[model samples]
Target: MTDLDFYARAVVDGTVMGLGQDSLPEDWEDRLGVNYVDDVRKGLMRRDFGLVEVSFQRVRGIWRCFGVGIQVHRLDRGVEAVVPAPVRAEFGEFGSPVGFAGVDAAVARMGGRLESANDGGSTYHDQFLSASTNARVHVVAQVDDPGVGGTSVGDVWSIHLSWRKNQDS
Candidate 1:
C-alpha cells in the first residue's frame, strides 16, 4: 500500500476499532460479522470533511455487527474525512398497517424484507492526515430497528452496517 493509503488504513482501523470498543456498542464481535477480505475493503480510500463533524447518533438496545457483503463496500475513515454510508433495504409492500397484533399476519404473508438507504454528500478536510489535504471516505452502517411491540424479537433495537472497506478497522 502507498504511504497515503497506509495512513488512510490507520484511520479506518481507528474508526472500526473505536466503534467496536465504544460504550454504545462495546460487543461488536457478538453484534457484527467480519472477514479478512472485507476487512481490507473496509480500509479503502479515506480523507476528511472540512469544517463538518461526524455524527454517530445515539441509539437504544444492544448494537450488533453482521458480515458486510461484497456488493456493499465500506470506505476508510481519516481525521479530516467524511465517509457517507450507502445502505440497501429489503422492505416489501405490506398490504396495510394494522394493529401491533397484525404484524405477525403481515409477516406471515409478505415475509421479511431489506432495503437500501441514501448515500449522499461530498465533503473533505485535512486534520491528522496532513496540512490542507482532501480525503474521501464512504462507509455503510446497517442498523436494523425491529418494529416496536414485538414480543419474540430477541433484539428489540439494533442496526446493521455494510459498504466499501469501506471501513471496518
Candidate 2:
C-alpha cells in the first residue's frame, strides 16, 4: 500500500508506526531512529517526522506514545521553510493527497463512528471512535465556510490519531 494509504488506514485502525501500542518499548524512538525534539523528562515528548508528528507521554514511569498528528496541507510558508527539503519531499512522494472525504470514507469502511464535530468559522473539527482499536480519531480541516449541519467538509488540514485515555494514566 502507498504511504498515504497506510496513514489513512492508521487513523481508522488507531495505529501509526506503533503509536497506539498497549505498551511501547522503552527504546521505541531508538528503534524507529526518530529523534524527539522535546525533552522526555517533561513527561511529554514530541517527534516530528516531516509529514507526521508523534507524541509520547510518561505514564507510570513508562514512555507511551499517545497520538500522531499528520499534516495534509502546507498552509504556513514560514513553517514550511523550517522543515528540511528531503522531509518536505516525502509528502510529494507519499502518493495522492487525501482530504476529509477520503478519511471519512476510510473511517466508514473500517467501522468507526463519528463522535462529535465542531465548526470554528475557518476551521472544522471532527472526533471519531475507531471500532477496531477503540481509539480516538480527530480530523481538522481548513474550510472557507462552515459545513452544513456541522459536518467537516474541506481540505484536510491535519489528522490526529490517538489512543483512548485510561483512567489511571
Best by TM-score: 2
lDDT of each candidate versus the true structure: 0.23, 0.53
What lDDT score is found at residue 11 in candidate 1? 30
Q: How far does residue 148 in candidate 2 sit from its true spot (Å)?
A: 24
lDDT of 2 at 165: 53
Clashes of each: 46, 0
Displacement of residue 1 (Cα, Å) in model 1 is 14
Report the C-alpha displacement of residue 124, candidate 2, in angstroms.
4.7
Q: Candidate 1 residues 1-169, lDDT tens each?
A: 2222222322333233234222232233222222111111222311112211122222233223322111111122232122222111112221111121232233223332222222333121111111111122222122244332332222111122222222233
Q: lDDT per residue, candidate 2, 1-169, as tens digits? A: 4444545566666765544554464444543445335545456766665555667777886667777666554333333433334333433334323455666675666666545445343334555555555444455543455543333354455666666356344
Measured on C-alpha atoms, candidate 2 has an lDDT of 0.53
Q: What is the TM-score (0 to 1) of candidate 2?
A: 0.58
Q: Write down the TM-score for model 1.
A: 0.16
